[model samples]
Target chain A: MELICPAGTPAALRSAIEAGADAVYCGFNDETNARNFPGLNFSRDELRKGIAFAHDRGARILVAINTFPRASATALWQRAVDDAVEAGADALIVADIGLMDYVARRHPNQRLHVSVQAAAANPDVIAFYVETFRARRVVLPRVLSVVEIAEIIRETTCETEVFVFGGLCVMAEGRCSLSSYATGKSPNMQGVCSPASHVAYEETAQGTTSRLGGFTINRFAPQEAAGYPTLCKGRFSTALGDGYIFEDPVSLDATTLLRGLQSAGVAALKIEGRQRGRAYIESVVRHFRRALDTLEDGSEADIVSLKPFTEGQASTLGAYRKTWR
Target chain B: MSHSSVASRPLPTIPPLLTLAIRPLPLLPLQLVLGGFLQRILRRNPGLLDRLGEHRYARFGIKPVDLPFAFIVEAAPPRLLVVRELPQGLDARVSTSLANLLALVEGRVDGDALMFSRQLGIEGNMEAVLALRNAIDDAGLDLPGELASLFGPLGEPARRSFELARDRLTGPPEEER
Candidate 1:
């Protein structure tokens, strides 16, 4: 299976390549990509340079223009597609059907990958994207178990990519509006979830309180580690308890299940953190590459070393071992 | 409004840091030591400055919230100087505890988690701060290791002492080195 990694900048792309990423996925520095964090992502010239650098070193670059284009601003996304194509992106990962259709009609030869934001869980939805947009691959959403994923792979013609490591979204991709309701900026429209501009923190006598758009998300004691105030991972007061009501502040680590995913005919394993720095990209990619090597040699990979790198210093198998559902 | 729709949301109101609540204490000795340490570290690893490229010229003010003084860092020419007061304008200003800052420099703690939890506060230009962070993180940072090297033949003992000090300060059983 191909080990795909995330890169937010040219420097990070280079780091990922050197660290043994088979392919590095990134996006232009704008709302066209979901990780629209301030000061992260690539410029067009940087993308061109990054693609050349990666391709020269026997690696591929996938451009993610994954955010939904506004009805009045379709031209901007179209231009991004055109620019990415011109920049020699190996493939374009897209979520919007209209944009996919545009790619099919205009750049028919361009290899399209369905973005996870599309949330195509079953074979029928995957087949639809494959048939209509000729999507060569579909990045499966984070809601399916290994058996379900295997079934989908068996039933669909498109290649399958699954996120093996990094942040886990509690909601179905492309469907959740909790962030939009709280901050008025949806990942689908603005490519930002729990935007920093809509976040505030106050060190009070009680604790360090984090709030998003005037609503409290989580509070941390002086000794406790605090996570990002992502709406989905926020601790809330419920009838049950004032704890993580949706999901805990944990990351996904599927290193142990790599063999199962490979047996299920998974084409790619993706690490999701384009907003991370080069150090993070390099370390994670190196570990995953080593694990893949060991797996190829029929050896079990020791994933305990990866504990230090996990978000919130915790890891879960996530939906792959789904008891949550 | 639904998930698909976009609307103009009001910007979040950031509560100002209450410097008045902090008891004024002597911190010049700590600031000088930190400033000297930073200068030595930057000198030894010029690559850290190079990684920032043009952004190296951008000025950063490092303010340890627990300390009374701040230090200004210029990565371009790579200079660190202790300041009695913060400059009027800076590309980025990071405010945190002295121990936390040391922990970050040593790569003993997760920088992202600290930022997320609001333990480390950043003010000023976002791009400069991001660039600075990437550069620092990319350098294979180890404050104790780097500082011990300055001691020549006494490096090993110095490193051990620094590690012990850090352990006492941070006070957590780390799972990974």
Candidate 2:
């Protein structure tokens, strides 16, 4: 399988390209892109430059115009698609049916992929995007197991990609409204999740507890590891008692499952940290590239070596093995 | 909208005392706390955070922003900062209102309230946010001592939680020798 990577900005794009990513996906710094946090993404001109940068290096750039267009502001999204085509984007990753309709009709030449945020878990939905938008690929949600992924692959001809090393979402992608529930903003509409704006950390006499908005998400002692404040995974209390009702603070690591993913007919493996630095990108891209190479020879990869690159210095095979109780 | 996003503060000079005092207060880690602070700052300052392009924090080792779009910071001293080089022609100055920003950094605000409201801005390229983030992470954030909201009844339920945190933690205060 090829390696698909995330480039939150032009710098990240170049970093990924230089680090050995077969292809890099990024979004404009607007609602059009799904990772719509404050300090991530590129502008139109930057996209042009980024595309040229990738092409010049024999790499590919996939522009993510994935957000659903609002009825009141359809023109803005239309302009984004226009700009992407004008900039010579290699592919357009989209989720909304309306936006996909616009792109497929307006720029039939543009390659289209389904954004995982759409949460199209079943073959019927995945095939729906492929048939409806002529999507060439579909980024599968994290909820599916390896067996499930193989089943989907068997049922469709669409090229499939799975998140190999990076953050993991326990909930179905695109279907989550947790961030919106916590902060009026959500990944679907606002392009932010557990938005940085709502996160808080306080230090007092006892220990450190991470809070999102005013809600206590997780509390940890000084010696314990700390992860970024993704609200869904936070440890908390409710009328039902205290637990990570959503998830724990563990990242998804599919390094050990690379051979299986490739055999299951996945066309690409993705690493998901556009918010990370170049150093992190370079290390992850290089390690995965090497692992995939090792698999070409049917040998077990040194998957443990990529530990430092994992978010929070930890990683797991996630649902691939169903180890969680 | 974060204070430091627009505030012209110097390099880090955390006294270690601040972090130590935070332990017993039933607070979260700094990573989680910083987001609410940044959001609150954005709300009060409005476009001031984008104004960093026009104004440079020389003390913080940041480059002087000369972006086409300029943002202002209605900070403590009221400065006109610019977010130079961006293609957007949006010009914003800091709103000079910071009750919310200060409150967030102080751990007085709630997470649910932040998402459920319209308090931040997205006037320019979102990609620049990362560079802006780099600047923030690079900046030496010395959180102000506006932590009055941490006491009282809401503070009682977490006493055991606090004890667990305190007992489990090791090492002396960050600043103490």
Candidate 3:
């Protein structure tokens, strides 16, 4: 019943709230949250200010302390929960069970939302977080079809949130460790995947070759537009040829599927691009808000305008339609 | 902490561009201010680090062993380069000033864009140079703040110098996080 927006920074948060987000989700600058790039994220004080700003506007703030705990840095993760509670975050979006246990016992008043990183697709796991950790909501992984979603809703008591637009994760959100296998960094441990420090590019006599930790992901000819070399979208040399092997490089555009999501008992829709700028936030949130309003008014929402923002200017229904694959 | 310390305390100069990034800047104190500024900004929006590809660390990845060991970025001149130790290393006399390097770093000058446009004189182990680009992705450049802090008052400028050059040498900043 709510439109959840992503806010990577204070400015982005303001943009989302002003643009009409019902709720906003963000994380601290450290390894506790995903999207852990340098020169980004709020300190504890900034989180307090951001929460205050959102509350003043009648919007909710969701703190994402979603990365799994590293054995050595468990204390930092525990402290992140304490700080978010001090800042008055409306909910704690968590993936690690250990962190969940820490919060449930130490700060019982805090609301806990299961992060998509937890990859809880079945009612059993959602029920696990809800029964054990008392999770109020679960952000479903992007791997299920709408029918599977309705089935999940029928069985679980927790609220549901689906990603409607922006980048799509090829692997299960919370469980992925592909980048770590190639480089030593794990999104779970370090809160970053395909970390910038491990990316390499070359403009040989050939067009351009993009590498992640020395592995060639994609090679753009002199003519093909060069996109950033993320691992999932990289061209791999399988027995199959040199092209995007795991998944194609495309943004998930679900404007046409909102009707199905709402009908399938989804309580909310989320847009995933916290690292985006204010302009990007404003544009995407506004578009989706209007789309949802139109749908509520008994009309089909138009989504043709969402093309430019898509990955490589291409969009796909992505696991939403049972037949997409 | 000026380039004066950098001059006599030689780490073996490969090229003026690869080492002392001196031109015009407020100096070490400025580095602290810059870090504070970044820390302040990051404190509010924590997601700003990974947008597009602007992050400093993505340049250091692990696989495909054929990658460069280091990069020498000069922001004022707008230059990004692959640098590796040569077998017969040159003891080229260092002549450039730090003030010039800082100005180049801040976009007060345009040295980097010039190199990209001209495809100028940058030499190294090209095969190995490929890896440095993905070092951030490789996690090689996971610079510890404490390691950065070891420079003491000189830390900020040193880090700033590394960041500015890295930003320039790397591709344009990624779209917002």
Best lDDT among the predictions, by candidate number: 1
- What are the candidates' interface root-mean-square deviations? 12.6, 13.3, 14.6
The digit string of per-residue lDDT tens for model 3 on A44-130 reads 887899999999989999999999888987999999999999999999999989999998999988999999999898999999999
Decreasing lDDT order of the candidates = 1, 3, 2
Over the stretch A3-111, how does candidate 2's per-residue lDDT look in tens digits?
Answer: 9988765655776787688999988878887787764577788889999989999999888887777789988888989999999999988888898899889998899
Docking class of 2: incorrect
TM-score of each: 0.77, 0.68, 0.67
Candidate 3: where are CA atoms >4 Å away? Answer: A223-228, A299-304, B1-177
What is candidate 2's lDDT per residue for B88-161, written digit by digit as tens?
24322111113323222222221112211212122222223333443233222223311112334544444445
Model 1 stretches with alpha carbons more than 4 Å out = A300-304, B1-61, B64-68, B72-81, B84-93, B96-110, B113-177
Ranked by DockQ, top first: 1, 2, 3
Q: How many residue pairs clash in each candidate?
A: 0, 62, 90
Decide which is better by DockQ, 1 or 2.
1
**TM-score, chain B, each candidate:** 0.72, 0.24, 0.23
In candidate 2, stretches whose alpha carbon ends up further than 4 angstroms from where it belongs are: A238-241, A298-304, B1-131, B135-177
Q: What is the TM-score of chain A alone in each candidate?
A: 0.97, 0.95, 0.95
Error of model 2, residue A132, in angstroms:
1.8
Question: Docking category for candidate 3?
Answer: incorrect
Q: Write the per-residue lDDT of candidate 1 for residues A1-325, one digit (tens) a residue.
A: 9999998767678878987999999998789999887656777888999999998999999999999999999998999999999999999999999999999999999999999999999999898999988999999999989999999999888999999999889898988899999989988878988886677666678877778888999987875656767888889988887888888888899988999999999999999888766545766787899999999997766643555456666789999999763
lDDT of 1 at B156: 91
Angstrom error at residue A118, model 2: 1.2
